[model samples]
Target chain A: MRNITLSKAVNEALAEEMRLDSTVILMGEDVAEAGTPFKVTSGLVEEFGTTRVIDTPISEPGFTGLAVGAAMTGLRPVVDIMFGDFLFLIMDQLCNQAAKTHYMSGGKLTVPMVVRTNMGATRRSAAQHSQSLHALVAHIPGIKVAMPSSAYEAKGLMKTAIRDNNPVIIFEDKLMYQDKAPVPEQEYLIPFGAAHILREGSDITLVATSSMVQVAQAAALHLAEQGVSAEVIDPRTIAPLDEETILTSVKKTSRAIVIDEGHQSYGVTAEIAARIAEKAFYHLDAPVQRLGAMDVPIPFSPALEDLTVPTPDDVVARALMAMRGELFHAL
Target chain B: MAKPAQKNSDAYLHMYRQMVKIRVFEDSANELYLTAKMPGLTHMYSGQEAVAVGICEALETRDKITSTHRGHGHCVAKGANFKQMFCELLGKDEGYCHGKGGSMHIADQANGNLGANAIVGGSAGIATGAALTAKTLGTGDVAVCFFGDGALGQGLLYECMNMAALWDLPVIYACENNLYGEYTHVSEMAAGALMDRASAFGIEGHEVDGQDVLAVNELSQQLVARARNGEGPFFMLLNTYRYHGHHVGDINRAYYRSKEEETFWKETRDPITNFGDWLVTEKLASFDELQALHAEIKTEAKAAVNYALSAAYPAVEDVTEHVFAETV
Candidate 1:
């Protein structure tokens, strides 16, 4: 095993796929010349040249729609939207066209395209630049959403997404890019609906995703001082969620805490909480605790911003309260 | 320009048959819609036969075309099955899209007909992308996108043109300037000239008389050949018009267009009658031969109607069948 950053893992995955298939092409705002906005595609332009590693104008709907057309015509194009917020401008291509092409074509054609966009906040980039809207995409049926928390999962899940016949949306968080993880040197791919158990304990289960995976680990370490063992689980993919892993952990630990970076109102955290209450209700000793961003616009001030998003301390406090059933009266 | 062969006489007659086939198809579809035989909205391609036939006749079998709402002529010229096309209009199971896609969405990927879009300028990007695929895969195929003058103002069209010109993609943008963009006149809605839009993207463009099939056909042959040879994209604006309302059930006339302009276009600028007259004067076909061809088309259209009426609807259980293939 070799330790690598998330950026190098993505670079290796793309390089391997490009080597395997000659028809694969990459296009985005700065994918060719300036590398990527996040530097994920640092040296691809020099390796593949300008033809295959294409640099496109700042036309999201245009380039994204073009990727859909190219995919339908026997070429698999991987498109990178500069930021997740800009995806709103091209919703017509994504929601109306790409998502419905195969269904409307009546199985005559397949749209084998991949869209990569960066998610979450870094250094107080403020409201428009920083947002986690994975829930909005998960609402649609045709696309698969991959939210990997480590370098190993990032490379493995991307290979699976590229080989899949359907459209896939891979959301990467900015904060998770520099995290270190040991990935295998040989070729490997992670299945779409599988989850990874990071830590094993018997007291409580902490189910998190993306950047919150680190936060969950920190919370588990903090809870160890009080003699409360915590188990951490990461549902690597959000759309076809691995509910079995989360449910099994909750059943053994008899409690759960969902740490999400998105808004608290009707988001992925709510979905996971609802599923656990429906299936593993009898095994739980208390109600599920959901720790997520506050229901407000992200502030520019660092002091105000720290209070909105969930921290490791917040996760630990919520987990200890739910473990003891102290926050609720009836429970 | 390439020489029109001694077989040009027979080819001219065959071209007339294609034009009349499209004219009769649109005419019969209009009549069927009046009798409530077809569902959804219908945009008949009544007067614009020369643009579709002239352009498609110049394309090789490996070439592809993208169409718009007024797409019956392009569909016929590209050799889409008439029986399946009518079945699609009738919403039958044997339709091009298994009855899921109606008139505006009929597509046969096997025939290289990419599909007709209902959105004003949606096909531009798709056609451009297909051209990009052809270049990347080293396939010697060219793509043509047919849109009205109304689509010239869309931002996506400009984006597609700039990208195609920058990459030297094998594409031909055939703009059918039918004078009217829905109810509004093109002079009012469109800005600048058509050739200026092409030049802005560094592409060679031409303005042709769309009523003359020979002129449009000659221009298309040169342009399509240039594209196939990897000389980059071409833009041609066909000055044409529509004989009917924007769509079926649109009878209000006094709102945007005057009756005099409509009558002038109907009498003088009719592409089908112009081509038929040329075929007769040039000794390509006699009057009886042309009349017999029209009667045969009517009979063929009648059989198509019968076939569409008898075809079955798609089963309800298969709604979620083709969302994704079983394997990559």
Candidate 2:
């Protein structure tokens, strides 16, 4: 295993896939010459040439729709949306066209494409630039949603998403791009719907996604010092959710705290919490607690932005509440 | 005034048969919808028969075309089976989309039809992308984007046009300028000349009489040849009108257009009548032969309706199937 940053891992995955398959092409605004603002595709153009690594004009719906058509016809296009917040601009293409083509065509067509974008707040990019909207796409039926927690997960999940026969949206946390993890030098793949248990414990279960996995792990470590054994589970993909892993973990602990960076109301946290409440109700010692971003839009100010999303401390506090049987009363 | 050349007689006959087939099929569909035999909405392609036939005639079986809401004409012109298309409109198990997509989303990939997009300007990018695929794969295939005048106002069209021109992709942007964007006239929505929009993107653009099938077919041949030869994208604005309303429910269109205007186009410049008249005048086919062909198409359309009506509905347990590719 070799240590690499999450951004490098994503770049490596694109490079590897492009090398393996000549049909694979990359397109986005500033993805070629500039490698995107985040530099996720910095050296792709040099390696694959401009034809394969394209820099499109700033039209989200246009290029996104173009990618959908390309996928349907012949090419496997990996579209890099500069920001996840811009998904709203291409919802018609992504949700309506790309997501519906396979079913709409009666199993006659398949869009083997990947739309890679970054999600999360706290970069001071403000409301439009900083937002975790994975839940919006996870709600879509035809498309698959992947959220990788570490460099290893990022590389493995991206490779898997590219090979998959349907449209897959990979939401990378911009804040975690610089974070490093041990990724294997050889090829590997992490299948969708399989949740990874980051830390093992029996007292309580903490379910997190994307950057929230780090927060959950930090909280678990803090809980361990205080004689609380907390289990941290990261569901790499939200759409094909690892229900069995989550339910089994919840059954063992009998208490669960769902963590996500998206809005608390009608978001990923609520969806997972509702599932646990319905399927694992009798196994639970207390109601599933959810800690997500505040209902308001992510503010521009550092202090306000920090307050909006769930912090490690917030996860620890929620875990403590669940352990002490005080979460219901505290609410 | 002049006879069609003996060499091109067969091609003209084929084009005429396809156009008549589309008209008869659409007329049958209207009857089914009015009589409550078919469920859901339909955007019929009644008057714009020549546009679909003209452009599709220039394409080979391997070439791809993306269509719009009023798309049955395109499907038929691209060689789709009338029986299967009828089955899809009726929402039967034997339909192209297994009865799930209904009218707005009918697609037949085998015939090189990408899809019929319900959203305005939705297929522009898809068609352009198919061109990109063709160019990348070294395939001689060309992609045709069939949109209406309404789609001209959509930003996605401009975006794709600019890219197709920039990349020199093998695509033909065939705009069926039916003179209206649903309820609003194209004059109110589009700014400057429609062809000028293509020139701004550095692509060659042309305007043709949509009612003249031969004129459209002549231009489509040039454009398709240019695209196949790696000469870049070509944009053509086919000036046409829809004899029917925007949809079947839009039977009464006095609110947006005039009866005189509709009558003038239908009476003087109806695409099918003009082409049929040309066929008779040119001695390519006698008047009796043309009438016989129409009868034959009508019978075929009627048989399709019967087939669709008798076809089974998809099973209840299979409702959620095909949501994703089975392999995925």
Candidate 3:
């Protein structure tokens, strides 16, 4: 196993897949030469050439819709949406067209496409660029959504997503791009809908997604010093969520806190928290807690933005609240 | 090559029959709605039959097409049968999409039809993407994107057109300028010249009489060949008129258009009637044969409608089935 940066992992995944199959093509604005603003796709155009590594114009809907059509045909197009916020521009093409084409065509058509994007805050990019908008896509029925927390998860999940038959959108936390994690040199794949257990404990269950997985792990680490055992579960794929794993973990702990970067209300945290509240209601603990980004446009001010997203301290405090049987949450 | 040199009488008769088939399909679909038989409204392709038949006749079975909401003409022209189309319209089991995709979303992939999108100008990207697929896979196939005058208002058309031109993709952007975009006139919606939109991207542009099947067919053959030969990504505007309103339920359309204009198109510029007259004049088909052909199609349409009306819907247990494909 080699400790590689998440950006390198993603680039490796794309390179490996492109080397394996000629039909796998990459297209996005600046993806070919500039390697995207995030630089996750650097060296791809060199390896695969322009025919496979395409640089599309900055038309989100245009390129996304094109990816959908290409997927329906023979090509496996991996579209790079530079930011997650731009997903709104291609809603009609992505949600209405890509998501429904297979079902609408009564199983006759398949859109084997992948949209690799980034989701997170703290880059001081402000509202439009920093928002974690995976919930908007996960709400749709047909498309699959995956959020990778580390380099290993990023590479494996990406390879799996590229091979999936349906339309799959993957959100990689932009903040974690340079972060190093152990990734194997030999090819590996992380299947969708499987939750990865980062830490094992019985005191409380911390169900987190994407970047929140690291936050939960930090909180777990701090809590372990305080003689409290916290289990960190990262739901790799949110759409086909591993309910069995989450529910089983929550059942053992009796207390749960779902953390995510999206807004708290009607968001990923709310959905997971509500599920724990509904299914494990009889497990006798404090109410299912949720720690998500504040319900406001992500602020550009460093001081103000620091208060919006849930940090490790937030998870520690929330876990303490559940531990103390405190039925109330604080702002 | 003496008597008008148009001796392909079989092809002429087939084109005539296809036009009649579209007319009959819409006429029967309108009756189905009026009699409260069909569940939802339908957009009629009555006056613009020639554009679809003209462009599609030039394409081989390997060629792909993306259609619009007003798509029955394209569907039939691309060789979709009446029974399955009626089944799709009536929401029955035997429909092209197994009744999931009704009139607005019918996709006959077997006939190289990508789909008919409900969103205005939605299929532009999909069509261009298909061209990209053909290029990348070296499939030697061309894709035709069919959108109405209304779609000119959408940015996606220009975006895809720009990409198609840049990539030199084998695609034909066929704009059926029926003069209206859902109760509004084309002049109110589109700015500047339509052909200039193509020239802005350096893509070749052409215009044809949409009601003249021969004219539309002649241009379509040349464009399709050029596209296949890598001299492609052409845009053609077929000037036509809509015989019906925005939809079948849009009966009171005097607010936007006139009865005289409608009558003028139906009487003098009807694609099927004019084509039939030309066929008889050129000795391609006799007058009686054209009449018999129309009657035969009408009878076939009647039978298909009856079959679709009696066909069962998908089973209740199958409601949640196929939300996603099981495999690639």
Candidate 4:
């Protein structure tokens, strides 16, 4: 019955987990008293004290590597990388050490840790700060990747990631931090690999992830006004993807379009679209389409930046093409 | 300053045995490579046995340690036997990591050895984090990070040391200055004085003759005890050497290092021979007794190699197993 912001949902999930388990620690730059640049971890240090909600230096690799070791021990660390662009700085610790520790150790050691980061474009933060790089991490085998679509998804997913036995990476769209959505007061968890079919239709499926879920939803509404019905689905976590849900929906609809904010080249859209084409080849009327961020460094200018990521109009136009069967060209 | 403890012949004999085990293990591993039986090459820990055995002897079975690519010595010193280690080196299922990880990534968690990192100075954070866990959980446990002079080139080590100093975590950053960073001499690799790296962060620094087991052990014991008391995050510089070429296949070394330098360290400053002579002079072990112990260790190492060579390889279906701790 109550609505909360996505950032607050993340903070609440961390606070609840920290209260439930003493070993759950929060470590990051400006995470303690400053509460992070987005204030997502605000009031955590006040309640859990400095030891639990740690304030680390500007050492990305340093603290990330430390989190790997701490997780192998008794502690469950939730490490915050302020921006997803900095994930490159911690590839060795995150991909090499944390991701592979469980397998490398033959299951003798487990790194039950969460790397919380924000990714999205159109912030006008330029190439250095704004980039949705979740597809890169999802390529790695050992890590689980989560993309929360709303405040409700954020709270449930954050709790699940903290308790996971292997390394997990949760990507939140920085632009959606303050976006409010209805969430339950009681404790709940959203299991990974489960797809949420937001709205059902028979003609076509508009499957998307993270912030793009809202785009698919808006496009579905616009398509309805234009006498076209579209189904909307969100694969909450990309790593343990609910392939069955997406495939079953595509099989019923006979047409699909996968949308994500990651780069279009070798990106999340390509992977999802390829999977649909491979599995649903017999059922498809027109080829499955992909709408993702353009394959270029995110620009700084607002006008230029807005052109990179896909929009609802882009989805609607693609849907109209599928309905008209124009997507099938000479190729 | 660490005060040397009153001597007991039993302690000397135990350390002597550990050092011999490492040496014999390395020698056998080298033979495994020469015969083309092992799958991949290995970084030998032969000459630096004292540095590992000395520090590990000062630790309890519960204390944790993060080792380097050159890690067999640390593994053996931290209570790992010959069979699992040889199996791991040979990439067999009975190995410590079930054959998934070879020499460069052997991790024996049951013995509190977290794992050996292939990256230089990579385990600094892991060791420090273990110390953080000990402090947070009140476990009274300490962590040792064993790296070589090459690790001095990594900035992560400095970051971990700075944080360790800030938190007063019980961790010892032990740098075995074996005078070479892979192939480059330490003089060319390191920028300034090595001990200054610790003092810049206000961490207590200590140096020891790594060839002498008692001296290195005495200091490690003092540091480990002090760390347990919450006065740690110390730094140790163990003046040591690596006898083999960087790896087993690196035999030609006329360009980087001369044969004389290698022979000098082997003959004059060999840790095992020096310690065995000290034990004989102190009347703790007879010369005949030391020779018999050496022979016994050699036989044990050879037997382990044979077992590992005969061990089964993991099934191909199991390749996907353990990628995740559990399916979620």
Under CAPRI classification, how is model 1 graded?
Answer: medium
Which tens-of-lDDT digit does each residue in B1-328 have in candidate 3? Answer: 1122243778878788888999999999999999999999999999999999988989998899999899999999999999999999988889998899999999999999998999999999999999999998989899999999999999999999999999999999999999999999999999899999999999999988898888888888889988998988999999999999999999998999999999999999999888888888878789998889888999999999999999999888766877888753
State the lDDT of candidate 4 residue by residue for B1-328, as single tens digits: 1234786888889999999999889889899899999998999998898899999999999999999999999999999989998888888899999998889889988889999988888898899999999998999999999999999999999999999999999999999999888878999989989999999999999989888888899999999999999999899999999888888898997878999999999999999898888778778899999999999999898888889999999889879999888735
Error of 1 at A112 (Å): 1.1
lDDT string, candidate 4, A141-238, tens digits:
89999999999999999999999998999999999999999999999999999999999999999999999999999999999999888999999999
lDDT of 2 at B91: 89
Where's the lowest-lDDT run of ten residues in candidate 3 chain A?
Answer: A322-331
As for model 4, its CA RMSD to the true structure in angstroms is 1.5
Every candidate's CA RMSD: 2.9, 1.3, 1.5, 1.5
Q: Global lDDT for candidate 3?
A: 0.92
Q: Candidate 2 lDDT, tens digit per residue, A95-164?
A: 9999999988888999999999999999998999988999999898999999999999999999999998
Best by lDDT: 4
Candidate 2, position B29, lDDT: 95
TM-score, candidate number 4: 0.98
Question: What's model 1's lDDT at B82?
Answer: 78
lDDT of 3 by residue, A1-331 (tens): 6799999999999999999989999999999889998899999999899999999998999999999999988999999999999999999988999999998888888899999998999999999999999999999989999999999999999999988999999999999999999998898999999999889999999999988998999999999998889999999999889999999999999989999999988999999988888899999488888888999999999999989999999989988988988866454
Better of 1 and 4 by DockQ: 4
Clashing pairs in 2: none
Put the candidates in lDDT order, highest first.
4, 3, 2, 1
**lDDT of each residue in B1-328, candidate 1, tens digit only:** 1234344687788778889999888988888899888887889888888899999988876677888989889989988767998988887778887777688877778877877888888888788888999899878888999999889888888888888998899999999999888888899988777789999989999898887787888888888888989997999999888888899877786798889988998898787777777778778888889999999999999899888978887888777777665454
**What class would a CAPRI assessor give candidate 3's docking?**
high
What does DockQ give for each predicted structure?
0.55, 0.84, 0.84, 0.78
